[model samples]
Target: MLKSRLYELSLFLTAVAIAFSSSEILADNTSFITAIIVFWFFSTLYFRLRVFYKNGNTNIEYGISYDLSFVLFAGPLGLFILETIYRFTVYFYRKWKKIADPNEFFDTFYNIGTFVITNSFVYFLFQHFHSSFQSFPFGYWVLLFILVCISSYISGAIMVLLFGTIGESITFKEGIHFIFKDISFLDYGKVAITNGLLFLFLQEGKWEMIISLFILNYIVNLSFYSKSQSIQNKLERDQFEQMAYTDFLTGVFNRTFMDKKMEELNQTSEKIGIVVADIDKFKRINDSYNHAVGDKVIQHFAATLKGYLSEDDYLFRSGGEEFTLCLRKRDFSETADLINSILRGVEKNSVEVEYNGEKTSIFYTASFGLYFYKINELTSIEKAYIQADELMLQSKQRGKNQVSMVNGLITKELV
Candidate 1:
């Protein structure tokens, strides 16, 4: 906690120093500063779009503000003034709607500081190499523009790395690696194109071209917002579908999913092995203890049974104290050994419950019935289910905790 505070304090002090230095530069370009501020205010009011990206373990939100300011070649002071006005405008709008964010100032200060520092560095480099830069050919301006964009990116990245590593378990190097992994060539291309267009308009001294570009910028930002919303909505729908198919109690597939999967399997001609298992005397445990303990027992049993299944196997909680396992590409002979192992594992495992401040241990067992047939051989899943259930009743009649197999061709009992 102390380290986090220290980092924040350092950030504030650096931002303050940069703000003071940039203000001095702005005083010299008063006419251009006023014109740029007016342009920035309208741009901020018009283009309020944000794109979100997941960076490793963190999520980052980007707005068009930076791109807009960069394209205008807004030096440290102009960039700082533009962002300050934009932030204030947004705060007031939200406040009028009675939804003001308390953290707005913190974000505003950080962003202004980042812009000041990055653009200041770019200005400094340009001044230092102004003589050599003047000697460069017109075609070489592209190379200079690329260098400026890279420097700005690196400067902003340093701030991100510093803050991202605070209160987290990642190193600076790892954070850089993760952040850069998401940065693509397209990002650079966008920056280059915007910078080129801005430069062209400024060279031609065409105010109308600048106005047209501003409109295009707004449209591009709107397109990005629409795309992000569509992606987010699709993800939400997929999540809801997953929840609908999942069992709330044992975290296994529920009856709805089981039925859906069976329907899909019916379309194929391959044979599938089916096993229906039930907890032996499950109602007695509920009567002896309580419903809570009974639920725990069912959960434990379901989890244990699921562990023995292969990748191609599916386990479903079809009903209370009852589960169905569907195996693909496995015959009755192969399933027999697997069923016996599960029966033994259950007999050895016990569920512990607490009642009236006293700890009690409860033991339980399960019965299984296995059957296998080609999809063409079975008329429907209900017919296969009836055959497996009847065989399970026979196992219970012989004695509890056993597997019974009846496939019309072979009848076997395993104890």
Candidate 2:
């Protein structure tokens, strides 16, 4: 917590210095310049604080504006305008799902283009608003914006070429390790930052300032790039930890994840239903055929089951031959039909394999046990899970390849 706060303060302080320095260089009084900087920088810091406080998720809290500096904002009003536009763009894309990459590139390429375009546009608009900078032609301003955008794209693209998705999220601490991970992003940031600074210096047609700014951009990008690599390593390690909770073969919750998710669902207002399933005579298949064939049968069984499920429902491989499904809505009927469809699908479809110099078809089948309980009322989610497990065992006893309900209300015949 202290570390995050300190980083936040550093960002705020750095941004403030940039803003003040820019105004000092301009030597133009726009009446309310000081107030604007205070408002803009503070507002940015405030948003950053709120983000860290509310969503502590690393991806959500600092991924967006962590690297951006104050000079990038131009002014408080400019900051507000850019943020509002970016936020709306994000919300619209997510809400309607119509938003797409304006620039076509895969992975880190997309972010490179996005960041460059945003910076160029913001700088262009902010410059146009400045009365002192009005001497420059609109076309000249546009040309400069395009140049800077292109430079940023190329430089940031370095990160893409080097580390791929690893370059996307870099904090100050991580910026150091970026040196070894991908120096391209460093070059990119350097060129972009320096180019912008050069443009500012060349406003007075000073050759030395232009050269100095150019060098500065390179140095800065190199430094940040180093940190970025370090950060990427940390993030990757964290993601590894997250994946530990997920099943390797199925890409769903493992027992560890299931326990955690069930705990969360127990605290919710809505009810959660737990369904347990097992492949009928799975051991016989492995014994009679082979584990290799058995594995294919398992994959086929899981794939069929996936088709019957709703988006909200979850599928899990509890162990070899044993499966679990968590149904969010719907009563036993819906879950029953879905599970039954999966069973029928598995029965109808067979995986063909060549063994002992002969080609043959392999069939797989499963039995399901499902139960639902009010999530709001459950003292524990284990109640539903245990009952569902017992019900699954009961299905094996009643007959193979059928769904049994443990909720005491609805049950289905296995045949």
- Top lDDT: which candidate number? 1
Q: Least accurate stretch of 10 residues (summed lDDT) in model 2? A: 51-60
lDDT of each: 0.68, 0.55
lDDT of 2 by residue, 175-236 (tens): 44432333254444443454455445534545466445434534554566567778878999
Cα error, candidate 2, residue 20 (Å)? 44
| Each candidate's clash count | 0, 19
Q: Which regions of candidate 2 are displaced past 4 Å?
A: 1-238, 376-379, 408-415
Q: Pairs clashing in candidate 1?
A: none
